[model samples]
Target: MPATETSAASTPGAQPSNHITEDEASLYDRQIRLWGLDAQNRMRNSTVLVLSLRSLAHETIKNLVLAGIGRLIIMDGEKVTEEDLGGGFLFREEEGAVGTERTAAALPQIKSLNPLVEVTALPTLEPFVGGDETAMITFLKREKVDVVVACDLSYAQMEAIDAAAHAAHTKFYGAGTYGFYGYVFADLGTHHSFTYTPPGKGAVKEVIRYRSMVQAFDRTNWALTHEKTSEGGSPFGGYRRVLKARQYAPEVAVPVLALWEFEKKHGTLPAGREGQAKELAEITSELQTALGVHPKLLSSSADVVSHFVVHATDYFPPTLAIVGGLLAQDVLRSISRNGWPIVNLLVVDSLRGTATSSPWGVAPDPTPP
Candidate 1:
């Protein structure tokens, strides 16, 4: 039967001492030297709930478990399939393994990653759904889960999870990868603080007020335009300015939004269908234009939009690794309160090797005429 696993420090309500054991100190000696003992202790005190058990989740679970989080609960009702064996290393190709539950198949490997970290497998997400969140919020509060990560779930699903996490006063993360593109969104909820060091400066403390994912999404000023060309040309250049200011380009971002909208309306991603790419392109272009992207920029992003429409449901391992690695690292940073977490949204363009972090919904910009 499926059940929650607990370690010495993982027992619910069990209080771990502030002091690290000599054995623990010796085992985590290198990391202790890097992040300091307090941060390590913070990690040792955290319990993370990760939704889903796909390749991205596989990579994320591996990173977090290896990082020595106190406890990890994986909730995935999916059963292993032949496709799962390709990227989910926790699954085996042996006979009879394909029909096994994903969490069950991956539990041993997750436990093996770090015996010090408590690992639990949840075979169902019964109480979690887009329209309702009572069960999820209750579970989060009941388990005292420090952070919740939703992977490869729909936008509305992520919203539901984020809402529940917000209610529980827990941090939330939503992430997904498509072939060569991916994104991660965080909602640490209203107020969060962490310690950091600046160049030529001592450790500095900082605080951030974050907006929920829904707020951020709603606040994005798709109509905001940049300065008009000096020659009295079009008044909108917002797309170029935003793109120039961001570490990641909007090429993938707009397409992702369009894909979500498509999925929302069509009940599936646009893939392997006749004229779907063209329809998706139309949607992307329409969104890009509506979102105030420069006409030239929209044209330049056509190839990516085309690729995204066709392969929107596909996954690539290398892309998953890059995105998943960052996602895991950020989750730990949020837990340890040691480093800067992604200030909300991070979009990665694997084809160009560029990942951009943008703060959405901070303030609404007037739509450019």
Candidate 2:
């Protein structure tokens, strides 16, 4: 969600505020100490694309909107649900459909925090990653999106965003949190770099550390040939037939295709256990396709963090605060339009009270061709 068009913030309803709300001012007090109101203004004028509108996704994004980021494209095909209300704090039980109904549902809440900020949310968002990367790439190229903030997404989707950002010459910041810890990776296109945040590590970096999990399964057909004595201790039985009946899971790419199909069939997954199963199944299927695709496909530190980072934040607001605060810094450094380095890797370990950072050292912002 780049700033293709200047926002309506100066409009009567979307006017900027002089005094921030008590709660909001309090919540963002520390942030003001770091960047001050000037940076907040930059945020108000900037447009950003948030990858998903789930728990963590919604949280970070809402913070941005409240903090006064002018425009937002909250990309997601799913609608709100009981589970969404449970996990996504920004949403309420009385809220209407997320994708179809609320284009500005979250704006009022943001206004409560900062009346000056202007926000318009969009649903029915498409995935940024795909084997058919051309569509999203071309879209972003035309749309003039300034930055992309992606949350817990698939491996290929993360890679697709990285490539799209690079090709379109935009900044891409990928962040995710799970249980207690998460990492943020900033790619300053072919130029620039993140100054404050670090790169990715731990489970988030596992995809890069290990070759394609898909390819491994493809080579051995391990899932199929896997034979074991049944609980009843049957003979060397289930093994032989199991291997013969189906194709290798990875080669079949059932997971990827299935995810595609699930979205097609079910526009809005039901909330609660049912929704989790539906989404999990789709992702598992997508993983299988990685076997046949290029192992390096969609591989980037940001992509890695977005895909593998497990988010345990039960609600949305906290997630948004964390992501918004970190990503906003990256955007500020990028707007300098001067020499800067993109962060290559950032491992934030709460246990260590440390953030492992790998920067592009220093470079100039790539003047878009």
My TM-score estimates for the predictions, one after another, are: 0.88, 0.52
Write the residue-wise lDDT of candidate 2 on 122-191 in tens digits: 5545546433557777767665678777776644456567766667776677665443344566665443
lDDT of 2 at 104: 45
Using alpha carbons, what is the TM-score of model 2? 0.52
C-alpha RMSD between model 1 and the true structure:
5.4
Query: Model 2: C-alpha RMSD to truth?
Result: 14.2
Q: What is the per-residue lDDT of model 1 for residues 113-180, given as tens digits with 9 covering 90 to 100?
A: 77777788888765665336777888888988999999998887888789878888899999999889
Number of the top-ranking candidate, with lDDT as the measure? 1
> Could you tell me the lDDT of residue 74 within candidate 1?
88
Clashes of each: 4, 22
User: Model-by-model lDDT, in order?
Assistant: 0.76, 0.45
